[model samples]
Target: MANTPAIGYKFDDISEINTSKDAWAVVATPIRLWVVPSFSGKKLPYSMELVLMDAKGGKIHASVRQSLIYKFQPLMNEGRVYQISSFGVEESRGDFRTTGHGYKINFQFSTSVRLVKDLPINRSPYSFMPLSDVALNNPDSYYLIDVMGILTGYSEELEFEKDGKKNKKMTIEIEQDGVRMECAFFGNYVAEVLGQIAAGDKNNAVIVIQLAKIKPFRGKISLQNAYGSTRILFNPDVEGANSLRQRFLEAHEPAAQVLNHLPNSGKISVSDDFLKRHWGKTVEQIKNMRANLKPSQSFSIPLEHNRTIEHNKQNALLATGSWGMRAWILESEVCLRPPW
Candidate 1:
């Protein structure tokens, strides 16, 4: 039971605790383990043990206290995700002969926040972060190889595990004229590149790389950016583009909260005249704050002047000019989506 504390969890921080630990030591232990997540709570006072993957820094387990159920007894269906905040624990006292040895923990659930999804960002595996932050109007029709700069140098490297239990990961860094970003040619790709580097300097081994949605940091450009690049697909890696798109969708899929927080107020029967008067003011304020021009920031504007104003997520309620383009304020710039 004393060793149950070290079950399977590793503590992130242990600088705050004052405790003496010895190998095969029989000592008093803390029995409570706490977890913060949106729990459906079908299993109350559940029988669970923490596994200590590391003897150096193991995580604490504070037994959960049904503070909510004890107070109001609301019906919480099992299988729902919950987010929790703070918690605590309890230890065993009594001696060996009379009461025997045992310790129990006490945990508390603080606030309940819903989970959200990621945003929609598309890109490639080889192009994980390969896009350079450049503007191209007719991007889709061109070859990305003609896009980015040349390759400069590359080096073989190793990726190490924290515990030193696993083998060092074999890696290579392909340096382009931009930033020396990495492209992994795993499995068979590793063997092929190994021979090329070993044979001589593969200095002339130049490949055309397409750049998109590149976030700038200093002057050194990095290859293959995922977000904002919009997954510009060129030749040789068209298959990779599809995979990149999937990842983008997965990463940026809106968190439930982000979507729910979107302004669902305003009216439906919005006309141009109504939009002209109201949209100008609202759009003006949004511009001042420098909100990213997203579907959420869109307002209807008529060809003649500012017309009727109706706030909504999207529909005819939001399109720009005849191009059906919607203004998006990203980071802090007003970017038009489906720009024509």
Candidate 2:
């Protein structure tokens, strides 16, 4: 008998696949994969969502229905190369679409998925939007975006009742190139971000949030998590993060050097003589002084205790300005006994 030749299957580019095709095959990597829950509040699995990227850097959203999740979940892994074929193609529709690709893949019973031992795609799957541009984003925008910045501050986790269920939320402030923006994480994401901060250094930590939605809350624009699709990375070891860290360091190097060279570098003393000179200044005057202050220059004004301002034993206020103008009250005996 003559030797039989194996049949070859052709793969289509992610960008080329559309609803017009019945049989489609593609070699792509699942950059992100997560299970979505039912919107009916039944606490049941709805479907498995994935953001897949081809070797050419084209990305498309893919979904495995709740019933087929068991069959496909085991066969696919994030960041791993796979040969997927015979999947259904449909028009992408969602209030918060993960990708800009007009079409998305729908895994069917006959959908074939197998692991490929080839090297995965090396290109970055992120198209990060600048913090400055965030304000310009339309609140009703359909597509989600990726963003990375330095974690400057965060609020306490708050619990609230919604739909007769308890939900948690936390707001974090991130800054990039002197521009600051707030992002709110809800549900399990509250714990996820806080856990990462606890595990690592939270000060000036580089945080990368992928597939974030731009939302308007209380008449202010903010970034928010898009259910299970949002991925949070803290101090990620990537090119963008390294570059941001480098820029931050370079910008603050002068302030850091100045602090290092100062005698008793960690402590600032407010003498009675210093307090006497600033004691009579009103809060408005102090605000004006701060407004006129130059970089790396600061002025301190003693606040009058009218039983309104909270104070500890020391009661000292220290105002300092560096690369970024920062002011904070310090605990010192000088503040405890103000010179009238």
Candidate 3:
């Protein structure tokens, strides 16, 4: 037997609630929650963002503004079902959208929340978009999406100044079906990825990034974290992750076996034939080759040429280990030397 609320309370479907309705209530579980930073650069958070899913599997984005945080923050809990009423409904317009619902819920001062224990609802509400589909998506689209794939490679943490404060960023490459996509994570997200890499085997690790924004650079598309809305999971114990791991291993077993036999040298070596062909190339020629170079590949340049490249494009040159091994790695920006 399931427990029910009072007879006067009628739960409305998430899809049915709109601004037209005078009173509405919904039984939904908060699947994802994050605190949005204040846009004004203040220390306090601007609002609490959430992705809620109803018993019918309908999802919606909800927000508790800063002013009302004290009142509602204590009552809300992630992964718990709640009966909510008296919330405001408004058009969901933003560069980063957590859900596809036409409208979003806003917690008003008069809003009510009650814990519900008997609702049968799906807890793992993930809608993963394929890597190939992400490449075809419009870069300027406002709707953010979820993605899951095998973690192939990642760049070293890069630090820079943003708004007079030091910030960190790291770029990672994920692959599926021979199609690879570059994803950049900033701030704490970079640490999260690094921590996961340190804790587990990096080879064939499954990664899931939720609500990532599509970005286009040069002629290719990539993914970037959408501020506080993005959620990252590394080798999570979920159905989607398990399925991806099995498929990737089955498809790439032969390739993996071949790679296992290859030398595990920390530095990549270039063939004499490749060096002979590219020797004495101008910096302009190297810039043109950026589009063709893979993230994992690196090429060497003479120490004399380093000064010329640095003088002309200082921002593009990320001085790495040493001048003796002037190996440049290609990413969104070229590095003067290999990270190793």
Candidate 4:
């Protein structure tokens, strides 16, 4: 698959299956999506395509793969290509009822659109160097940060589809500003950030965004660390131009307040006796100590899987750029290595 020609699409990744002519006998799973573009503060969802494309760029007969009703769902409002939602792996056999006949990969849905600029940038703005005497705790403000993190835990338990597809509905835990917060990914819309962020990495950039208060649930006593329990769709112009990094760094420049002042937002001190410190304190206590660094300082690696980001990056650059599905276990995972 390394030699597979790159296709032009928004997924930024792709995975091809190893199949043969025998695949035609198995049922092709179909997916239906509702597309909605917000206009005037209201959202309207509509149905779109039923596509059947072969690996060689030919259209497969939808009826032969599944019932007429199941094979004819819309492609999408944005006209993205469709893939098997859950298909059988039976070889030259039409046995929907047989075990070992097939398996499933979670169907993925995505839409790539440019931000209208005026469209609100969600989340908190910069802190630290860009700080002021004013404490703006509004829930709807956006922030500028270059730091990239990963989803460590989800509030809701995850569920898989019939054919072993991964359907996860959970809040992400992003380690930002030396703290972790609850983030979220919706339905099939979770954009895979495989190569972008790692577990304990911190990269800074300049920015001007906002910070706001939020409550994950009702009756909650204290506020949450999340700007919102929302998966923010970053503006491509900013993401592509590295403006997000720029904005994040701008916030950390020396100023009225440094991030290190706060216990949770401060830099971590590393020492050969790091484990000795843990003996006398609770995890939270030691964590708070680490967080209480001066704004000018940084933190230590908190997770052993820190290599997650770099590992995914090679996988990301190797696949085709399509927004629909990000293939993780594809053979091409080994193709794209960074130049020394």
| Among all candidates shown, the one with the greatest TM-score | 3
Query: Which 10 successive residues of model 2 have the least lDDT summed?
Result: 259-268
Instruction: List runs of model 3 lying over 4 Å from the truth.
Output: 1-4, 137-140, 253-340
lDDT of 3 by residue, 1-340 (tens): 1245546777889988778876878888888888888878898889998998998888899999999888888887788888888899998875577778889999999998888777657656787788888787543346778888888778777777755778788888887776788888888998988898789877888888888887644446778788888888888877767777778888786556221211111211233222332235544666765545565654444532133333222223422221123435343444443223
- Candidate 3 yields a Cα-based lDDT of 0.71
Candidate 2 regions exceeding 4 Å error are 1-8, 41-44, 137-140, 252-340
Candidate 3, TM-score vs. the true structure?
A: 0.72
Which scores better on lDDT, 2 or 4? Answer: 2
* Candidate 1 global CA lDDT score: 0.30
- Model 1 scores worst on lDDT over the 10 consecutive residues at 93-102
RMSD of 2: 18.5
What C-alpha lDDT, on a 0 to 100 scale, does residue 59 get in candidate 1?
25
Model 2 lDDT tens row, 160-266: 76557878888787878877778888889989987987899876689999999876443456777988999999988867787887787777654432211111111
lDDT against the true structure, per candidate, is 0.30, 0.71, 0.71, 0.26
Per-candidate count of clashing residue pairs (backbone under 3 Å): 63, 0, 0, 48
lDDT of each residue in 1-340, candidate 4, tens digit only:
0112223422211123324322222112221122223323344322222222222332221222212222233322212333233332222222111111122222223211121212122322212221111112322111212223222332433444533444544343432243434433334433332122333222332221112223222222112222121123222233322643443345445451222211122111222123222123333443344445554554333322121211221122112111111123222322322222
